[model samples]
Structures are given as C-alpha cells and as structure tokens.
Target: MKKAEEVRRLERDRIKNNIVVTSTDAKGKSHEDIIHAEQIGTKIITSELENTAGKERVMKNKHKQLQERIFINNKLTWEEREKRKKMKQRMEEEKKKGRTANMGYQKITIDGKQWK
Candidate 1:
C-alpha cells in the first residue's frame, strides 16, 4: 500500500509539471499558469495532447494551398505549370545555398493576364 501511494505521488507530480494554462489579463498582459494535478482532469490532458497533434498535422500540410492550385485547378496552361515548377526549383536551390526560402507562389503574368 505504501508503494502504491508513492507511485501515485510521483505520477501526480509529473502531471502537475506538465499541465500548462495560459490567460490574458484585463490589461492585455499574457500570463502562464501551471496547473496542479489535483485541479486537472484526464479529459483536459487528452484534449491538450490532441490539440498539439492537430497543430502538427496542420503544419505538415501547410502547402495545401499550393497543392490545390497545381493539381486541383485545371485552369493553368502547360507553360504556366512549367514556370511554377522552375520557380519551385529555384527556391530549393536558394535553400541549398543557405538563402532564405521563399514559400509564397509567385504571380505569373502571361499576355497581360495575371495568374497566381
């Protein structure tokens, strides 16, 4: 029974250290509050974990807009597609050269028409 109590105390300490709470006061200052294990629920911990996982998934798919423009939108001509490919290659080369990578798609103008 003493060993079980000791294990529970250790687990509670771990939980207390892990649970973080952030709030904004009326003066617009941000404050971070660490929650104790006694004030936290299993649902809160699971939801926070899920929220973090969701953010990572979103970051992984940050190129969804470009993908949609290239694959889903069939309005682009072959020449425009080739230009976009070249731009992407140039961006990759710049990254390899230790330059800042440009992730924004360049606006392509062909014959007074603008295509993003």
Candidate 2:
C-alpha cells in the first residue's frame, strides 16, 4: 500500500512539476517509464533491475545521454519529422487492416446499445 502510494505520488509530482523525465517502478517491469521520465527531464526511481546482471546494458550511460538530448528538444529535425509522418501513416494502415480482419473486435460505442 505504501509503495503504491509512493508511485502515484511520484507520477503526480513529475506531471505537476513539468519535469522532462521521472523514473518510477509502479508496474515492476522494465524501466521503460524511466525513459519517458528522462525524456521529459524527470528522474524516476525503480528497483526492478538495479541488482540484475542483464540490466547493466539498460543502465548504460548512453541511455542517460539520450534522455538529456530529449529534455533539450522534444521535436525532431525536419527530415526526422517527415520520416515520422510516414511511419504514422503506415501504422494507421496496419490498424485499419487489423480491425477489418478481426470480427470479434467491435468499434467502441460509448453510449452502449442506445440506438442513437
């Protein structure tokens, strides 16, 4: 209970403070949240992989440097932005195909079965 409270508090602090990166371990998974926090200049704390051997790679200094870069500028260069736009189009097409292929997947109707 205390740990959960701490995690929530950290998350709230990061958002409220408008930090670039904040590390946290609310889900006990890979320290992906740290990447987010770091990107936004927030420092998060996670005990998931500190003592593990394989995590040494994830804990590398290069990752920290990248976070610093993100903190400086969240935007990509013109070329990179163009590449991202193309990537987004590709992803949208894939999502459309997936939805068309799956019969069980229903489009969300927020009002339930109400016949609009």
Top model number, TM-score: 1
Supply the TM-score for candidate 1.
0.28
| TM-score, every prediction | 0.28, 0.24
Candidate 1: the clashing residue pairs are none
Model 2 C-alpha lDDT per residue in residues 1-116, reported as the tens digit of each score: 99977876666444432222233422223344233322222333323322324234443433554544421112233444465566555546656666322111122222233111
**Model 2 segments more than 4 A misplaced:** 1-73, 99-116
- Each model's C-alpha lDDT? 0.40, 0.36
